[model samples]
Target: MTSPTISQIGEISLIDDIRKQFSQKLRDVTVGIGDDAAVIKPREKYLLLTTDMMVEGVHFDLRFITAYQLGFKLISVNVSDIYAMGGIPRHVLLTIALHKNTPAEFVHMLMNGVKDAMTLYHAVLVGGDLSSTQDGISLSATLIGYAGKYILRSGAHVGDRIYVTGSLGDSACGLHVLKKMKRTVSLNKKNARGSMHSFCKKLGAMHGGPARSGLSWKIVEPLVRRHLMPEARNPQKFIRDATAMIDISDGLLIDLTRLCNEGSTGAKIYEEKIPVSIEMKKAAECLGIDPLTLALTGGEDYELLFTARQGKRVSATCIGEITESQRVIVNASGKERPLSVGGYRHFQ
Candidate 1:
């Protein structure tokens, strides 16, 4: 039987369902849903606030993502901002607008994704609003966090070493693979195990019944997963030593430029030191693209880019160091050139 749509359920029912889904009592929250405003207990630590929006046909394409993945990614994106400041996420507020024709099942899946992500971050859903739209979906989230000592993008100084929490370009390469496959992969734990069979079979069929361009599911899976459901990297391990920080949401060069501009300093990075995964390398080769270009310009990786004082012990990959007045990249052959300030900009 076909499921009902949101219009049939009414707005009040929809709000009630969401409220019940996240009705947990937390010590930090005195009032949650059903209230005019949420009451959060004050904390001694510094409070961090951040918000992000995802619009249909602009920020995302439903054809490439499931409602569950969409919900999870929205939360993760905002949480990354808090983490970039070296803060711990504690509370969340969401605003979602969907067409009246949107299926009830889609709403259920979306809330499931949101709930699971909140649980993962140990955060509570204090409150939010819901509304019906005319055509497509629009989602926004506000994340509140706390930290004893917060890091900023303007804190880097000359002689500080630049570090990245993990490998880059995986998410961008994954996006390329998805565009070729023209399909969505369900990443829920219950269905993730068997998702590969369908992902490979369909993609193979598109390219004459074999993995496309000699790329197997093992290699493609991580790339696509990185794009669909990226996890926010925690900075707790090295937060104390970090002098400056930002998350690579818009691409390495653009975000790095923001950090440099904030501190009024220049940066020099080594191409050999930039971390690129083996999966991305092979996939990029098969797709006839340059891996380094992807690593440098591909955005939405959600990895942390930070700076720390030189000679300090840091566990992350040290890619380069801060310079006095020039931003350049050193090639393997020792060629020096200006760093390109290119990334995902809103208006061209």
Candidate 2:
């Protein structure tokens, strides 16, 4: 039996199904899907708006990732921007363009991912536009959030300390491993635990297997999962004392450079202080890649990197301090080099 495609299902029916899937009643939402536009109630706090796009070839590859993961990541990446400003995500709008021949099952899985992410973030899906594309998929999301007080990248002072909420480089390393495997691994809760043995067997068969180098499923699972479904870090705990903030979406050096540029200041971070997970280290070694390079220059970690004034207690890892004029990275042996930006850029 041939499975139904979007072309066979028709746009009207698909949209109606989508509306039913996301139907929700929220206090702030006056009008949701099935309306011309969404109406949102005004809030007393400051409003934070952000939008992000994920194009098929440019942002992701379907071969290495599932539609479910893609949908979840689309919401996560946008929410990270709001969290970077110390805000609580409230509402969401999505726009998706897909090839008419795309499978209905794929669309359903994608929506399930999106719905799960919306629930995880306590956000409501209000309204969005859907369209047919000639070729690849394009997804965009707009997130609305509220904050009593927001942090900005331009607020750092020369004496502030720089911090990161969690470990880095795992996503980049995971991506590398996935590219080598040339396959997808489902990290969904229901199926992952029972399928580890088969997944490891598949991993072992790839190019003599990095598993031969002691990269077990335990080591590879987290790395790939990080790439597939990264949760945005909420800055509520550190927002009070944060002098400056940005999410590590495009690598530490590039994002830190952005923060420094916004503040018209400089920074000095110690190489030894940058956090790298044990899994990432082992995986990188098996792949013959430098863990520090991935940590410093890789993209899409979504960890919050912020600065705070000295003498205040912060729950994040303090890797550096703000400087008066020069941006540099201090090595373990006291060697200093200019901090150069490196990460994903659309155009060369």
Candidate 3:
């Protein structure tokens, strides 16, 4: 029998089909997949669960990525969600659906990546499922975390200062490299190993470090390898003092807009104060792309965009201030202009 088309089944039906495969366990399960992850009540803490899925073609390309990098990235993305809510990740469960021809060695390498990440983040792999598929590889991880008091997107006050972590746009640089690799594959196929090594060298030179810094080998390699990995800013402690918080999954402008929209306020972001990485700037120049736009609209950085009081006791830098109006503004060249939320829209 032919498989049902994604359009015919729709997202909800597809979710239902997948949900039916799991046998319900555990009592006091207040919520499940519909919201984010499954929420189970503990004796003292509230568990926030979230899961993310990555597919080979749609989410990442294997030609430029190693199995280990893929494994590490899978956990990082899910961990970012927990951090966004000021939660500490406690455990994770990973499910892999691999093509029948996929080598067991490759799978082991991927698991090694997962193991490395768990050790780095101090999270445990409680349990998971494995299966074979006819199509491509798919990895899904369910992350369980604990929060004393959740910092949500809906808690921004009117006078909070917007802050973000780390420099932005490196992931976009990685994506550019992947696109170049795909186009040059035919000519460079014979020298694939050499070419990829050179590409990684260039990427490292741009970033000023080898992709992996020992413990972060899995996490950083994918960012340098395929640009498919998301960052986990791990802002649990930072968000504890924040008035509002959000993950930069949809780019700075878009995710900040979500925070502002939630609080019914506006902002004045200083273009000069925005953090853009050196590697990102070089990559943008090489690709003829605007660095600012990449910082503004490039998605999947996975950094935290949070808000706090202007003089709050936190180690956050204020890139912008909250305003009474409900529109975002960019201050550049001593002139202010309205900023648009033209960020990555998955459906679009």
Give one digit per residue, the lDDT tens place, for model 2 in 1-348.
666999999989988898899888878888888778999885746989999999999999999999999999999999999999988998999999999999999999899999999899998899888899988899999999998888899999999999998899999988987887787787865676556656555655553564475667788888898999999998876546798999999899999999999999999999999999999998887777788999988889999999999988899999999999899999999999889763333212
Candidate maximizing lDDT: 2
lDDT tens per residue, model 1, 47-72: 89999999999888888898898888
- What TM-score would you give candidate 2 relative to the actual structure? 0.94
Query: Which tens-of-lDDT digit does each residue in 165-186 have in candidate 3?
Result: 8777667656666665563221
The clash tally of candidate 2 reads 0
Q: Give the Cα lDDT of each candidate.
A: 0.87, 0.88, 0.68
Identify the superior model by lDDT, candidate 1 or candidate 2: 2
Error of 3 at 323 (Å): 2.5
TM-scores for every candidate against the unseen true structure: 0.93, 0.94, 0.74
lDDT of 3: 0.68
Lowest summed lDDT over 10 consecutive residues: which window, candidate 3?
A: 212-221
lDDT of 2: 0.88
For candidate 1, the lDDT comes to 0.87
